[model samples]
Target: MNKLFLVPLMLLPSLAFAFPIDVTKKLNGAEIVYNTTTISSNMAAINIQNVGGTAAQCRVVFVNGPENPRVRNTVVQSGSSSYVTANFNRAVIRLRITLTCNPT
Candidate 1:
C-alpha cells in the first residue's frame, strides 16, 4: 500500500543523518575532538584530533547491533591529528573512545 511505502521512505532520511557523533572534551591541558560518522551502509569513519601541547593515546571501539566488535588504537602527537575507519556488515549502533593524555 502507499502508506507502507511511505513509512520506509521517511526512515531513509534519518539514516543519512544518523552518523558522525561529534565529541569534544578538554583533559589534562589537551583538547580532544572525536567523531564517528557513517561512511556507507556498512562502514563508519573515525576521526580524532589532539589540540594542545602534549601527546595523547586513544582507544576506540565501534559496536554494531550484534556484529563482531571493532577496536582501534591511535596516538596523536601534540598539535596533531589522526583518522581511521571501522567496517561492519551492518549498521553501527554505538561508539566508545578512551583518551590518555600527558599531564601538564
Candidate 2:
C-alpha cells in the first residue's frame, strides 16, 4: 500500500476509540450526588443523590444528548437511592444537574 494510504488506515482505529466522559453539578442546600457506570459496550448508567434537605428537588439534563438518554426507573433521595442511565455510540458523555429546595 502507498505510504499515504497506510497513514489513513492507522488513524481509523484511533477515531473509533476517541471517547470522553464529562459531568457537572450544582449545590442546592442538599448535597448533589452523581455517578456513572459502564454497563456494556454501548450502555451506561448514572446515579444522582439529593442529600441536602427534605423536599429538595433535582433535575438532570444532557448537554450533549446521548444516543439514548432515558431515566432508568430510579430515584435518589436522602436516605434512599436514585439513578439514571445513558446509552451512546461514543465514549464521551456530558451532563448537568440542578438541585433546588422547596419553595417557601
Candidate 3:
C-alpha cells in the first residue's frame, strides 16, 4: 500500500515541469510578446500579444514538436492578441516558434 503512494509522488516531479514560453522582440518599430503554455505533456496553448501603440501585424508559426509535425500559424493584430492550441502524441522535450511582424 505504501509503495502505491510512492509511485504518484515520484511522478509529481516530472509533471511539475511545464513549458511556459514568453519571448519578447522588437520588429519594425513594434513590440511582439509571444507566449506559450504547456497544457499537458503533449499539448500546448499559444498566444501573441501586441503591446505597441501603433497598429501592427504578425504571423506566428509553431513547428517541430513531438506528435505535432504540421506547422501551426496564428495572425495577430496591433493592440490585440491571438491564440492557438497545439497537440502532441507524446511528451515533447522542445518546440520551435517563429514570429514575423511589421508595423502599419
The Cα error of candidate 1 at residue 64, in Å, is: 0.7
Candidate 1: where are CA atoms >4 Å away?
1-30, 93-104
Clashing pairs in 2: 20-92, 30-52, 31-52, 75-81, 75-82, 76-82
Find the candidate with the highest lDDT and give its number: 3
lDDT of candidate 1 over 1-104, digit per residue (tens): 89999999998866673554433333555577765566776676767788766777766666665776677777788777788687776654554434444434
Candidate 3: where is the Cα deviation over 4 Å?
A: 1-26, 65-69
RMSD (Å) of each candidate, 1 decimal? 5.1, 6.9, 4.0
Per-residue accuracy of model 3 over 1-104 as CA lDDT, tens digit each: 99999999999877875764443344666777766788776677767787877666665555544444445554556679877677766665676656667877
Better of 1 and 2 by lDDT: 1
For each candidate, the alpha-carbon lDDT, in order, equals 0.64, 0.51, 0.66
Q: By summed lDDT, which 10 consecutive residues of candidate 3 come out lowest?
A: 64-73
- TM-score between model 1 and native: 0.62
What would the TM-scores of all predictions be?
0.62, 0.49, 0.62
Instruction: Return the clash pairs for model 1, or none.
Output: 20-37
* Residue range 1-104, candidate 2, lDDT tens digits: 59989999998865563335465555445565666655644455566665555534555544335444443333355655466665556554344333223311
C-alpha lDDT of candidate 3 relative to the true structure = 0.66
Q: Rank the candidates by lDDT, best first.
A: 3, 1, 2
